[model samples]
Target: MKNNLDLTQFDFKKDLPDWQVDLITKTLSRNFVFKDFEAAFAFMTLCAAYAEKIDHHPDWSNSWNQVKVQLRTHSKNDITPLDIELAKAMDAFANQIQKPAEI
Candidate 1:
């Protein structure tokens, strides 16, 4: 087993605290609503950059005015610090894009 992690800077408690139990990757799911596909895609583009910058990617899908994102660290096979960092990063990027908190 890995060392216990600190959750100070991450919002895991609010959305995924229990995710720590399962050693198989954890998914942080959020649903974003927009006025149209254009707006939805725009938010996704920004998220893409944020994910790349942090070296953590997400599993996402878009439909009409809604976008769904699920974050997980595949290689670790568990919820590690990287997933926490990505959650924080996504929160910031979503806020910057005027997306309301849903996670």
Candidate 2:
């Protein structure tokens, strides 16, 4: 499977919250909710920059306050380490933006 990871062995629950592996599409997907559209867009921008740096882009869409991201190595026809790495980066980025203001 070249760059592919055995899905059964990967611990997605521990790796990222609300992330799921879709067997049918061979992709790891997650949805992130933010306070508003600006926050959502900012998150997407951060992901975009990272994706460009790694040359591995995500299949994603942004609504007003939500961003849905799917990661897969299309060329490899499966989920690869890149998907996991990106998912982790995304989780970190989301956490930074969605944190509650400490009073």
Candidate 3:
């Protein structure tokens, strides 16, 4: 199994697509907008399954048509490679499901 990666070892702006890294909170966050609540919930479901598989859950919430995700290693108290991997997975998942009009 891979361990947590130091924040200094990664480049957030270059590696992550739409994610924003918060220096203070040590979190990577992104907001995904969908066509409706159903789509948003569906996305969350997919994310939940993936998170469970990886054992790296995200702090996330869903609104009417939007899902907000925050990723960090609670044990490490900083952003890690797991957070980056999860963010990438989320972006890929969102891209796959999101409608063309929404993009």
Count clashes in each candidate, considering only residues at least 3 apart in sequence or on different chains.
0, 0, 0
What do the candidate models score in CA lDDT, each in turn? 0.66, 0.88, 0.85
Q: What value does the lDDT take at residue 74 in candidate 1?
A: 74
Which runs in model 2 stand beyond 4 Å of their true positions? Answer: 1-4, 101-103
lDDT (Cα) of model 3: 0.85
Collision pairs in model 1: none
C-alpha RMSD of candidate 3: 3.0
Q: Tell me the tens digit of each residue's lDDT in model 3 across 57-94.
A: 99988889999999988988988777888898888888
**Model 1 whole-model lDDT (C-alpha atoms):** 0.66
What ranking of all candidate models by TM-score puts the best one first?
2, 3, 1
Top lDDT model:
2
Clashing pairs in 2: none
Q: Per-residue alpha-carbon lDDT of model 2 for 1-103, expressed as tens digits?
A: 2365778887777766679888888888998999999999989999999999988999999999999988989888888988888888999999988887689
TM-score of each: 0.67, 0.89, 0.87
Worst-scoring 10-residue span by lDDT in model 3: 1-10
Say what the RMSD of model 1 is. Answer: 6.0
